[model samples]
Target: MDRLDIIREDETLEDLQINGFSVIQKKEGFRFGMDAVLLANFAKLKKRDEVVDLCSGTGIIPFVIMAKNSISKITGVEIQDEMVEMANRTARYNNVNDKAYFVNGDLKDKDLIKTLGKVDVVTVNPPYKLKDSGLINLDDRNSIARHEICCTLKDVVEAASILLKDKGRFYMVHRPERIADIICEMRSYNIEPKLIKIVHPSIKKRANLILIEGQKNGGKFLKWDTALYVYDENGQYTEDMNRIYYKRDDDNE
Candidate 1:
């Protein structure tokens, strides 16, 4: 067996054959889901771009983007030590250690923010559930990942604002219920909300996810892209969804 196979005993390696990119996720506890994939695909990254992913669980966002884009460097800031270690291992296994890195640090820390300096793009798949609003997950990892246990919505947006260069783009995937909150928080920091896409599970249901982008110090104009439906009537992926899932090369170019 290959070294990856041997090391993957306690984890599951998801292979994206498009660019030979793989992400190693824990067998249990805080595994990435479709949200991370959507955010990666949703984010607009260019070649040799300096990117940062906040609340980057296992570095899925950076790994997925690096697979398709020729990024100069991408750093993932995660609060969880285990996730950071796992992400670094995945980076090495994928032969992208030089271009990708994972650091264990709280995004709310100004010191950590200063060390990162400026970046071309900032992406976040932040905790969607507000603290004290809903039931918290029993698992410690999942609790921190899903709920605003470590950081709140404002904190995530502020971190992104601090990390971005002037006119730098910030992309995030969040629950639809918090769209107003997201827009407000972003605008409060001079990160103008410029683009948005609503994601629906099916045509019959309401949108549950919002993929939004803002430009630091940008003008106040919001463009709403066509809505995305994950499934068609027969419970299969829609054409756009298929393109989203598999259009690794086309979108990157």
Candidate 2:
């Protein structure tokens, strides 16, 4: 069995001490901070709807969604057993274990989709590339999380198409360079790219990431926006980001 490192723990949430679990990353690689928050905050949840978050690392996305909306139920699927276990623990700690379930399984597995049936919405922060598209990490977890070692974008989209209903929604984040391929793939699966927004680091920089919402039976329409400037050449989050990061939920009031 692979051993895990624990850096610290509060009463509820625990941090992954080592950078082993890049998927759920507590400290290092791709922690569920800006990207996750941006997606969750941008999401418009519907009442009495079910959401399935594919590749739901530490269950942070679902947790945030549940906090903001009153949905029917939320389900999380993670390919890694350790990640599933950790997410289950997070559910328990948050007292939402009964409302959500984390299962360890592959999205490409058809049987798993049949058992879970259809969902209203599905979200994913999938692996970026063709595994070796970039330099692979020495650590196994980080490598898989960053690269498409386990499943590719096509796999995620196909699985989501199978898991969603006729008009179900699929939300995802991916590199902007692959825009054409992603649209082609989604359309092939009968999932139309209903809306899309390209995320840029700054007004000066070109788009880096694409955030999209696809519907099972909807047509093509793209909406682009300039979001999140992480640096101003001096390597600090720009002023707009400060407001986004620190601002509380306006709907709360």
Candidate 3:
């Protein structure tokens, strides 16, 4: 039997398009969004560096980063068993199983931490809402992915700090409202906030998402890039946004 044929009825392969990579996505459960793409784009990865992605739902960050950069290895740590299997299957489908692997374990587990070891970079798209702060999703999978039921903001930051080597970068995408808390968590864990970029729907709209990069045991200077507008007045994707999602190489050069 062919490997592609093993895809379940509830799952479908979606093309990333930018780098000719495809990921298996479920029909109803937690799905990768533009935030994953933005986080991958926001992260700066080296060709020979090791990377670990925490809360790697379906391993979108790993897949997208591997597609765009020539990284040595990437391990996606996910608590969800189904998502871990799907991420591993995606590595097989992309013929990058040796370079990209998925591990099923909670980020806070000490044994899991030992299994991960240290890495040059840690990227995460963690649950944005506090456990009881917002309207929780009825679906268990969605709920865990959206709310901090299993792990809170501090948990994610600390995990990243523990996994990253000195001066290693930690990249994340989160709700703009949590910027203050996010920065505080990073600093408390000794991960210095180095860069931040705001994502806005349009020029006139308030920002909704923020991309941040912190370095473990690094300096205190924080650099803010120009605000990124997803759409223009005409409602079409901005050229900058287009380059991030589609024309990745155009900006890499």
RMSD of each: 3.5, 6.3, 3.1
How would you order the candidates by TM-score, starting with the best? 3, 1, 2
lDDT per residue (tens digit) for residues 1-253 in model 1: 3546535667898786657888888777678889888989999988868999999989989988988788889999999998999999888888889889999999999889979989999999999998887777545889899889999999999999999999999999999989989999999999999999999999999999999999999998999999999887877788887786775334433
True-vs-predicted CA distance for residue 180, candidate 3, Å: 1.2
Runs of candidate 3 exceeding 4 Å displacement: 135-139, 247-253
Give candidate 3's TM-score: 0.94
lDDT of 2 by residue, 1-253 (tens): 1123331242233432212212233444445645665576556689988989888877777877776678888999888776778777666655577888898999889899778889999988887777767678735776776688888888999999988898898888888888898999999998998878777776689878778888997866756655656555655566665544453334223
Q: Which residue runs does candidate 1 get wrong by more than 4 Å? A: 5-8, 137-139, 247-253
| Residue 248 lDDT in candidate 2 | 35
Assess candidate 2 and give its TM-score to the true structure. 0.81
* Per-residue C-alpha lDDT of model 3 across residues 1-253, encoded as one tens digit per residue: 5778758899999989856799999987778999999999999999899999999989999999999999999999999999999999989988899999999999988668767889999999999988888777645998999999889999999899889999999999999999999999999999999999999989899999999999999998999988999887877788888787775434434
Best by lDDT: 3
Off by over 4 Å in 2: 1-30, 137-139, 225-253
Model 1 scores a C-alpha lDDT of: 0.89
Clash count for candidate 1 is 1
